[model samples]
Target: MSTGPVTIAVVAGEASSDLIGADLIRDLQRLNPGCQFVAVGGRHIKATGAELIQDNEVFSVMGLAEVLKDLPRLLKTKKQVVRTILSSKPDLFIGVDSPDLNFSIAKAMKKHGVPVIHYVSPSVWAWRPGRVHKMARFIDGLLTLFPFEVECYSGTGIDARFVGHPLAKQIPLQVDKQRSRAQLGLSDKKILALLPGSRNREIKELTPVFAETVRKLNTSDEWQVVSSNVSEAKQKQVAKLAAEQQLELNFVDDTSALLQAADFALLGSGTVALEALLSKTPMVVAYRISPITWWLVKTFRMMQLPYYSLPNVLAGDFLVPEVMQNDLTTDNLLTACREVINDPQAEQRMMQFHHIHQSLLTAQPDQAARAVLNLAESLC
Candidate 1:
């Protein structure tokens, strides 16, 4: 056994992935004193004592068109990151989400004989199923958040483990709506939580439509609309869009609290939808990518799954209404909200949320960390 500290190279390119990385790093440090991390991530991972090579913002863009626009610079950064990680001579490499960037870097590390683990399986099961074979070529192990994802790696020769979702454990099975509302200074009126998205491009694409939805909803005092506070610049952009629709929205910093207080969540199709589900909040998920990207996806028949939202994907059914692309008009969004609000089966839906939430709870908190270190030791 080695007496010296073991170094782990990591890359977590989004806020959600950063949270996962932070938890994993904390466990690794607790189990192995002097466990060091070199990473690419945001505040959460950096706060865990990882030396960040670059801010996560560089790889934040999504969709084919958006990624292409920043490809040159992203490629430059990736090359630099690859060189830095290789030179670090890490005992192990962990790529947390952001498969677009991490897979390439993981491939490089694998070529150099570094044991590679990919945290958070990409949506290969949902689309581009062929990615499973590609991943088998690089990663020594795969850590998946959802249970169903492990089945996707069967026969791929990758040691895939279902570490359970961190959020499922972090969020209580039952939420106190009134208490969360009191904390956020929210009224008892039907609360509508709007989370356009975290990234600038996502906010820009969705804010206008969201603002219009608010404008239509403003016709009556039945709804009190709120949004989660994002970056100051993005907040200002949202305000500008709302102003164009002659509407103003209240912004709160605690998204989890807001979701708990909300009677209904109107948000983009991403992690926030999962948050809303775990909060036991009814929601209508909406999303719109760039036109070219949408066209390319459609023309090429890239999407293997009918649903896009995390909750829906997890359930393997359309558990919630998904308003998307050209269909994501203000009228449609409003109608979906109304449907969720008036649905007779709302309580049944909450029961389903409970079922899914319970399904994601792992008995051990350190499974991910233990799995990573076990892989590293095996390589030696």
Candidate 2:
């Protein structure tokens, strides 16, 4: 009996990871045309011809309340996945982000003699540094976005690589603000980009404050609000919120363009912050996960990071103001945005953002694909 073409199993549970996973799949396909992918992914990875085992996005949940609400379904899905992966082992199993979900899948697949590679380094450097110990048990290799992340794997013998984020290459080093605004059909009005987040629960927690901030900022409609909505519901939610406050937002799906067109941004703290940095759009960040989630996190002291936003973590300093939780108020957000917009250092900060972008550029998809392939070859 002959083994057919190399078969890899991948699981990417979030939109960001889906994009990274798709890029990786394309590059892997280029190198090994006959390679087959059995995956738990979303639209992006599916676009690359990966066979779907499950829609990974369903497993993505934020806040303790939300997770608990969906816990029964999550457990059921987890068991179903365990059975799926173990039914027939593939050459390699790659888990992309959602380490909470991915690592569990990896552990199961690892026991079945599958070489396990995790695409994103869970913020062990930021929180629960102790996870470095557990990493050795399941993760064979870790593909990281930032070069500094390699330090997180210091004591662990786990293989890690800095593949560089694809966005650094995808987004232009310098965006033409005039062109972007022209394309978006905006006039002399200063643009304030709003990126609440993709998840409904996150929008629920943050959009109210975001609406208040926009209302305060748009006095006399001096600034045109441009918000990016990840889903139709979020777009409608933003619309409802804007209508309630009598605010006008040029809601668009093309977030990158909006980021490029904006004078500055007010966004929820997450991957959008990273995207803002790549777009060279100076922003003030905020987040509110739920009261119970906040209490539990504080009670347990779960997070170990000095900063919350990706730009701050990457720069090792407060690159932009992050007003999280209770501090995320209209007055505070307005102050931060005005400070950034009016400060003489605005250009200087954009320059710093440019430097950070340069630092993130590398042989992306190819290097990442090769790393995964090599790990699988060595293990299998």
Candidate 3:
């Protein structure tokens, strides 16, 4: 074993990535106490003792239009990160989740002899399969959150490994809903947890539709309608909308706890859907992006998939309903949610989720860290 300090350069752009990056760093430290992490990360990564080179927000935006608006700042941040990383010449570079932003950065760093390990394979199996060759040029190791992604990289000459997802192991197979509800002081009549997503763009697009759907629920007052926003600003926005619509809703701060409390959830199609599934909460996923982004995705055939939500995709069949764009209406959403809420099939769905949960409990961080370190060692 090498006695010298192992320096790692990491960039994690969002909350989910931050959590994974943090866990990876903690496990890497366990493997080698002399490991030093230099990163651009959010709270979770910082909690694991990384010296943050920049805040994760510097690269946190989604959709074509949103990214276009922040392109200049993003470009500048990439240059700054490249310069800083080159000066130190770390043993490993780990780009977590933000492949749309971090892929180019990793490619640039590879020119300077830094071995890059990208955590969370970009949805190549679903779309953009051509990028595997491009990824192979820079990424020495590709760590995946899903088991299926490993086969997607086969014959592409990329060293891919499935590290599983931390959420699977973190959440218990059975969530104590009654205790969670009591903790939130929620009353018993059909609790609905609304997760509109964590981004400002998501809030702006989905909140009105969700607010309208909340209004249309039968015996609305009997059912406790609650939403958890990612920011205080979004919570305030939901509050204003609730007042305008004359609806009663509890806006909570802790999303995980809210997922535990939910009998079912109306969520935006993203990581939250997976979280809700991990909590064994049946959900109706909905999303509406800017028309430009929607048009570009359709026009270019960017990421055509049979199912968009993680649960449905993982199951290889429809376990829940996911409505997108114009179909994500108040009436459609309300109807879909009601059907899911009162379904006899929900028990089977929950059982399937439990099996998926167990399958995904493959100890993510240790596996991911070991993969990256093995690549680093081979490079040495």
Candidate 4:
């Protein structure tokens, strides 16, 4: 271990990235006890003792319109972050997820002679493939969660590594469904996990559709609906909708346990969908964005792949059904959920998803942590 103190800069703009950043910070501290961390992050990263240079909420806006509205504040925060990095002259910088903010900041850092390592390579393969060229120039190394992302980055000559997903390592290799249910105080009766999403924007866009779908399922007594707790405000919003629809919904903050207790899930298309896959839960994915954003995506044909769910992406087929944007409706979501939940062979097929999860775990022994450390070592 180096005797001298090393300052490392990190930035994780949202909840999922914050979790990954926290894990990386913990592993980095373990690897080099003298290392110091400073960055823009949330509660999890703060728990790891990273000095806050800026609050992550400044850059957490989603959707085109939302981002555009917050552009001025976002730009000011970016300048402050860049100024901090330049003044500190850290040994290395790690940007975990949040490609939009992280990529621009990494570009600035690289120009100032700092080695930048970007975790969670953006979905360039899915949309905006041209970003690979820009990323190759700005980022010293790129760490990816998905195996397929490596090929995309390698093709562009970016120093990229498939670090596997942190969740794959964090979640248990062998899941005991019955034990999980018992731990969550759930019964042997079938359970349906509802991950409306963690962000307020996501909940707003998805809750109505989700509640309607649950109402149509009308299997209130037969299947338990467990809605994830995003925040108190969002909880109230979702609760209001559930109450309005007279739907029985269990809103829980302990999402991990809730997911594990689930027989299957109806998840919004994002990190939660991937988490559900890790829990080996058969799921139907649904998502709806602002109408303008939806139209933009469709007009540009931004989605290169047919499926949105990560499990389906990994399988290279429509293994899980996705109803997105204009296509997402109560009837479609209900139908997909019913098919997946009621199928006699569903449990066995979901085991196949677990196989995919196992394959993703190829980056073992703390791959996310190791990748960040390797990048730090290369810089030294």
lDDT of each: 0.87, 0.83, 0.82, 0.80
Residue-level lDDT of model 3, residues 175-290, one tens digit each, is 99999888987787677887777677777777778877877884537678888865687688767766676666787777888898898898888788999999999889998888
lDDT of 2 by residue, 339-368 (tens): 887888888898999999999888543788
Q: How close to the true structure is residue 103 of candidate 3, measured as C-alpha lDDT?
A: 90
* Per-structure clash totals for the candidates: 0, 0, 0, 0
Could you tell which candidate, 2 or 4, scores higher by TM-score?
2
State the number of backbone clashes in model 3.
0
Q: Candidates 2 and 3: which is better by lDDT?
A: 2
Tell me the lDDT of model 1 at 63. Answer: 93
Comparing 1 and 4 on lDDT, the stronger one: 1
- Return the TM-score for candidate 2, rounded to 2 decimals: 0.93
Candidate 4: list runs displaced more than 4 Å.
Answer: 1-3, 155-157
User: What value of lDDT does candidate 1 attain over all alpha carbons?
Assistant: 0.87
Model 1: residue 277 alpha-carbon error in angstroms = 0.5
lDDT of 2 at 347: 84
Cα lDDT for residue 198, candidate 3: 68
